[model samples]
Structure formats: C-alpha cells, structure tokens
Target: MSDASFSLNGTHPTVNWLGQVRAPGTPGSLPLIRQTVVEAAETCGFCDEDVAKIEMAVGEACTNIIEHSYSTQPLNLDIEVKVGRYDNRLEVTILDYSSINFAVDQMAAVPLDDYIATGRRRGLGLFIIQSFVDKVEHRFVCGQGNELKLTKFFA
Candidate 1:
C-alpha cells in the first residue's frame, strides 16, 4: 500500500488524496482490493450505501481483469488498484499488466429483463459495475496495461 498527492492534466482537478494496493491477479486478492477500496471510500466521507456500491463496482472490475484479462496467461500477474479522492468524487482505477487488450467498447450490454427472466446467474459483471458507479473509463497502451477507472460522486 502507498499514498501520494498529484495533479493530473489541466482539465482535471488535482487529486486530494491517493492510495494504492497491488496484489496477485487471483480470486484470493479480490477481498483485499475490495477492503482497501471500502476503507478509502469511507475515509473520503462516502455514506454506507455508497461505500457498498463502490466496493461492488471495484470488485467486479478486478474480477473481470483476473478472469478475462489474465485468463490466457499461466503466471499470476499483479493487479494494481489506485484509489483517489477528488473534490467531487472517489475514483478507483484497476490496472492489469496482462498483454491481453480487451475491447471495452465491444462489450455487449446484457438484456437485464431477459437475463433475469431466464434465471441466468452469470455475465452481469459489467452491468453491475456500470449501474453502481457514476462514471467508467477504460484505457490501454501497448506496453503499459489496461486501466479501468470507476468513479462515484459524493452526494
């Protein structure tokens, strides 16, 4: 775990506080990531319900990286989660170092009504994440890694 304060681009506000956690990209690491995010959100003055929502959203994002992004690789890569507190929102960025570059735009929306009616149990990670967070952004660089940013505005 680490903490820092830094300014982003001119268009964005400077992050008031930032903390990060890195763990192996495995199911076992999800709890640690979720707990760290929850603690950060609470410290940022998020309400109980909002903190729960952020927790779930970050969990889903990390799960996708572990299950999909690192699925093909044999070794366990590290997943870096950065929690940043801005003036209006709490942002959690999940980074995976896998070589796989997933198409975030190409992820098809799940038909919630049909999905629930069919009694399906899986494939709703993205939906849950989008529904919980105020904003979601994905970026990937060839040599760098894929970063999924989830933000929840303070109410």
Candidate 2:
C-alpha cells in the first residue's frame, strides 16, 4: 500500500504532540526531533530531566525508523505523544507499510559488561534509549510497515 500523507488530528485527547516528515532521512533530523518532542512534552508538564531523556530516546527511535523501516519512496511516518497526569509519559508510534523487524529487547540487553571491558564506544543508541523509556513495544503488519512504540515515564 502507498504511504499515507501526514495530517493533523484534532480529535484525539491524548495526542499532545505529533509531527510527520517526508524529507530525506538524515542525521540532522535527530536534533530537530529532540527539540520538538521535548518542547511539547514540557508544555504538557513533563519534568525537565524526563523531557530531555524522552527527547533523546525518541530521536534515536525515529532514526531507527527512518534508517530501517521504509525503502523505495519511503512512506509518511506518524508520531503521537500523549502526556498523561498519572504517568506523565511520552508515547511515540511510527506508521509505515514495512513489516516490523526491529527488536528493542535485543537492543536493550546490550552486553554492556563486554562493551565496558573492551572500552568500545559504539552501539550506544539503543542502550541509551532503553535507559530512558519505561516500555517499548512493536506492532507489525503481515507485509506492511511496523509501528514502533516507545514510552518514557516521568518520575
């Protein structure tokens, strides 16, 4: 199926922040995403530290989405962040037509001890992301793009 265009949804109570971009996926999107998501979360009452973490983690997740999810005229991705009172969490979901193939668990259990032992300075994005988020989930279509869900809860 063709990717859908990005649109504003004004009816979702929980959708405090959302944005979609079709530009060429690049490293530069990282900073832009971090700033936008964090600013929006702060507006919704997320703590400063929590906001910073969420921004960083979400930026990493989005980078993964862009790099791994779509190919050949990439599809539009939907990002939705809901800031709640009890949880004060940021929920991010990516939409596309590609099947889900990324694994957060595999990424989370990074064998940090080995890395530390070797003093390796790589493969830190996933590790950093797991440290920030309380939960990460995956919803995949049979032959469609995967929805990568990332959440960061503020304490």
Candidate 3:
C-alpha cells in the first residue's frame, strides 16, 4: 500500500478536489483503490447503492489493467487513480503506465443471457464497468500511457 495525496480545489468554497492514489499494479492494491473511490463518492453525497456500484466498477477496471494490461511486463509499475467531485457528478481517472496498446474498440459486448447460462466466470469486467458507471472514456497514447475516465452523475 502507498500513501494517498488529497487536495481541495474549486472556484467556489463548497466544492472539493477529492484526492489521488497510486498503487502497485497488482490485485493486492484493489482494496485500497476501491476504498478510496467509495470514500470519495460518499463524501460527494452519493447513496449507498451508488457507492457500491462505483466501487465494483473501479475494482473491475483496475483488475483488468492488472490482469490484461500489465500481464506481459513485471509488476513494478504503478496504477495512478484520481477522484474528483464536480457540480453534478463524480469523476474517477485511472492511468496505467503499460506500454501495451489495449484495443478498447475491439471489446465486443457480452451476451448476458448466454454468459450466465453457461456459468461463465470471466470476461465481464468491461460489461460491469459500463453498466455501473454513467459514462466511460478511455484513450491510449504512444508514450503517455492508458487513461480510463469514469463519471457518475448525481441523481
């Protein structure tokens, strides 16, 4: 586990700039990442159910990075996570320093009925993430790394 850095930035006095966390690209760091996101959501006045959804979504994303993005390389790299609170939504940005270019467009939607009927236990990370979050955006740069931004609007 690593120390998380928090800051407060806003044009007005009521808003806050949640925090940022950097954890090793491994399954062991998921709990911390999830906890940080949960806290940010709660602080931003998200309900319990929504907070749970956000936690699960963020966890799945980090898991995908660890298992797929960094699979070929060593586990020494770090996954940077930033949580922010806006007027009507909460945003979470996950950055991975893997050199592998993940083909986000190539991910096809999973048929839930058949998937469940077959008792499949894998390959649903992106589905869960899309279902849970209000918006999902990802981009990969040649040398910058991969960035996944998830946003959940307040209801």
- The clash numbers for all candidates, in the given order, read 0, 5, 0
List ranges where model 1 is wrong by over 4 Å.
1-4, 8-12
Candidate 2, residues 98-144: lDDT per residue as tens digits?
45566664555576687788887766678768887788787666776
Please provide TM-scores, in order, for all candidate models, with all chains considered together: 0.89, 0.66, 0.86
**Residue 110 shift from truth in candidate 1, angstroms:** 0.7
Please give the RMSD to the true structure for each candidate, in Å.
2.1, 6.5, 4.1
TM-score for candidate 3, residues paired by index:
0.86
Ranking by lDDT: 1, 3, 2
1-155 per-residue lDDT for model 3 (tens digits): 22333344734423356868998999999989998999899988889999999999999989988998888886488999988876688989999998887645346658788779889889888778888899888889987678988899999
Instruction: Give candidate 2 regions above 4 Å deviation.
Output: 1-23, 66-88, 96-100, 105-108
Task: Give lDDT tens digits, candidate 1, residues 99-144.
Answer: 8886553476587897898898888887888888988888888877
Ranking by TM-score: 1, 3, 2
Best by TM-score: 1
- As a whole number from 0 to 100, the lDDT of residue 151 in candidate 2 is 72
Please give the CA lDDT of all the candidate structures: 0.84, 0.60, 0.84
Worst 10 residues of 3 by lDDT: 1-10
